[model samples]
Target: MQQQAISTEQSSPLTLSVALQVVSAIAVGAALLFVVGFAPMDVAHNAAHDARHSFAFPCH
Candidate 1:
Protein backbone atom coordinates (compact mmCIF):
# COMPACT_ATOMS: atom_id res chain seq x y z
CA MET A 1 0.00 0.00 0.00
CA GLN A 2 1.21 3.54 -0.86
CA GLN A 3 1.53 6.06 2.00
CA GLN A 4 0.04 9.56 1.67
CA ALA A 5 2.35 12.58 1.75
CA ILE A 6 2.08 15.02 4.67
CA SER A 7 1.93 18.79 4.02
CA THR A 8 4.77 20.96 5.41
CA GLU A 9 3.08 24.40 5.25
CA GLN A 10 2.75 26.37 8.52
CA SER A 11 -0.24 28.68 8.96
CA SER A 12 -0.71 31.46 11.54
CA PRO A 13 -3.70 31.26 13.87
CA LEU A 14 -4.34 35.02 13.54
CA THR A 15 -3.45 37.51 10.81
CA LEU A 16 -1.51 40.72 11.55
CA SER A 17 -4.23 43.07 10.26
CA VAL A 18 -6.92 41.45 12.43
CA ALA A 19 -4.66 41.67 15.47
CA LEU A 20 -3.99 45.34 14.84
CA GLN A 21 -7.70 46.06 14.47
CA VAL A 22 -8.44 44.35 17.79
CA VAL A 23 -5.70 46.30 19.57
CA SER A 24 -6.89 49.58 18.09
CA ALA A 25 -10.48 48.96 19.12
CA ILE A 26 -9.46 48.19 22.70
CA ALA A 27 -7.26 51.27 22.92
CA VAL A 28 -9.99 53.56 21.62
CA GLY A 29 -12.55 52.11 24.03
CA ALA A 30 -10.22 52.57 26.98
CA ALA A 31 -9.51 56.14 26.00
CA LEU A 32 -13.22 56.92 25.69
CA LEU A 33 -13.94 55.45 29.13
CA PHE A 34 -11.05 57.34 30.67
CA VAL A 35 -12.19 60.66 29.27
CA VAL A 36 -15.90 60.31 29.98
CA GLY A 37 -15.72 58.33 33.20
CA PHE A 38 -13.26 60.69 34.87
CA ALA A 39 -15.05 63.96 34.08
CA PRO A 40 -14.96 66.67 36.75
CA MET A 41 -18.69 67.32 36.90
CA ASP A 42 -20.61 65.64 39.73
CA VAL A 43 -23.28 64.20 37.43
CA ALA A 44 -20.81 62.54 35.11
CA HIS A 45 -18.72 61.28 37.99
CA ASN A 46 -21.75 59.85 39.76
CA ALA A 47 -22.97 58.16 36.61
CA ALA A 48 -19.63 56.54 36.01
CA HIS A 49 -19.36 55.53 39.68
CA ASP A 50 -22.79 53.93 39.60
CA ALA A 51 -21.97 52.11 36.38
CA ARG A 52 -18.83 50.68 37.97
CA HIS A 53 -20.80 49.46 40.97
CA SER A 54 -23.40 47.87 38.70
CA PHE A 55 -20.65 45.95 36.95
CA ALA A 56 -19.15 44.92 40.30
CA PHE A 57 -15.99 46.91 39.63
CA PRO A 58 -14.39 48.36 42.77
CA CYS A 59 -14.23 52.18 42.65
CA HIS A 60 -12.87 52.66 46.16
Candidate 2:
Protein backbone atom coordinates (compact mmCIF):
# COMPACT_ATOMS: atom_id res chain seq x y z
CA MET A 1 0.00 0.00 0.00
CA GLN A 2 1.24 3.50 -0.89
CA GLN A 3 0.60 6.57 1.31
CA GLN A 4 -0.19 9.94 -0.31
CA ALA A 5 1.34 13.12 1.11
CA ILE A 6 -0.69 16.29 1.58
CA SER A 7 0.53 19.63 0.18
CA THR A 8 0.39 22.72 2.43
CA GLU A 9 0.12 26.18 0.89
CA GLN A 10 1.88 29.24 2.33
CA SER A 11 -0.25 32.31 3.09
CA SER A 12 0.60 35.84 1.91
CA PRO A 13 1.13 38.92 4.07
CA LEU A 14 -1.76 40.73 5.79
CA THR A 15 -3.43 42.84 3.11
CA LEU A 16 -5.25 46.19 3.05
CA SER A 17 -8.67 44.53 3.30
CA VAL A 18 -7.77 42.91 6.64
CA ALA A 19 -6.31 46.17 7.95
CA LEU A 20 -9.43 48.11 6.95
CA GLN A 21 -11.62 45.63 8.82
CA VAL A 22 -9.56 46.15 12.00
CA VAL A 23 -9.70 49.93 11.55
CA SER A 24 -13.49 49.83 11.14
CA ALA A 25 -13.88 47.82 14.34
CA ILE A 26 -11.69 50.29 16.25
CA ALA A 27 -13.56 53.27 14.86
CA VAL A 28 -16.94 51.83 15.81
CA GLY A 29 -15.73 51.00 19.32
CA ALA A 30 -14.32 54.51 19.74
CA ALA A 31 -17.56 56.07 18.54
CA LEU A 32 -19.56 53.97 20.99
CA LEU A 33 -17.22 54.88 23.86
CA PHE A 34 -17.43 58.57 22.96
CA VAL A 35 -21.23 58.46 23.07
CA VAL A 36 -21.24 56.55 26.38
CA GLY A 37 -19.17 58.52 28.85
CA PHE A 38 -18.97 55.88 31.57
CA ALA A 39 -16.04 53.53 32.08
CA PRO A 40 -16.26 49.72 31.85
CA MET A 41 -16.36 49.44 35.62
CA ASP A 42 -19.35 51.75 35.83
CA VAL A 43 -21.06 49.89 33.02
CA ALA A 44 -20.53 46.54 34.70
CA HIS A 45 -21.76 47.91 38.02
CA ASN A 46 -24.93 49.27 36.50
CA ALA A 47 -25.60 46.05 34.60
CA ALA A 48 -25.12 43.94 37.70
CA HIS A 49 -27.30 46.21 39.78
CA ASP A 50 -30.03 46.15 37.17
CA ALA A 51 -29.90 42.36 36.84
CA ARG A 52 -30.15 41.96 40.63
CA HIS A 53 -33.14 44.28 41.08
CA SER A 54 -34.91 44.73 37.75
CA PHE A 55 -37.19 41.74 38.26
CA ALA A 56 -38.24 42.40 41.84
CA PHE A 57 -37.96 46.06 42.64
CA PRO A 58 -40.64 48.58 41.72
CA CYS A 59 -39.25 51.44 43.81
CA HIS A 60 -35.99 51.70 41.96
Candidate maximizing lDDT = 1
* Model 2 C-alpha lDDT per residue in residues 1-60, reported as the tens digit of each score: 011111112244546445655676787788764434333456644655554355443222
RMSD of 2: 14.5
Candidate 1 residue lDDT tens string, 1-60: 011111113234446545655676787789887755655667766778877667665454
Cα RMSD to the true fold for all candidates: 13.8, 14.5
TM-scores for all candidates? 0.43, 0.39
Stretches > 4 Å off in candidate 2: 1-14, 38-60
Q: Which ten residues in a row have the lowest lDDT in candidate 2?
A: 1-10
Compute the lDDT of residue 6 as modeled in candidate 1.
12
Give Cα distance to truth, residue 8, candidate 2, Å: 26
* Candidate 1 Cα outliers beyond 4 Å, as residue runs: 1-14, 39-60
lDDT of model 2, residue 58: 27
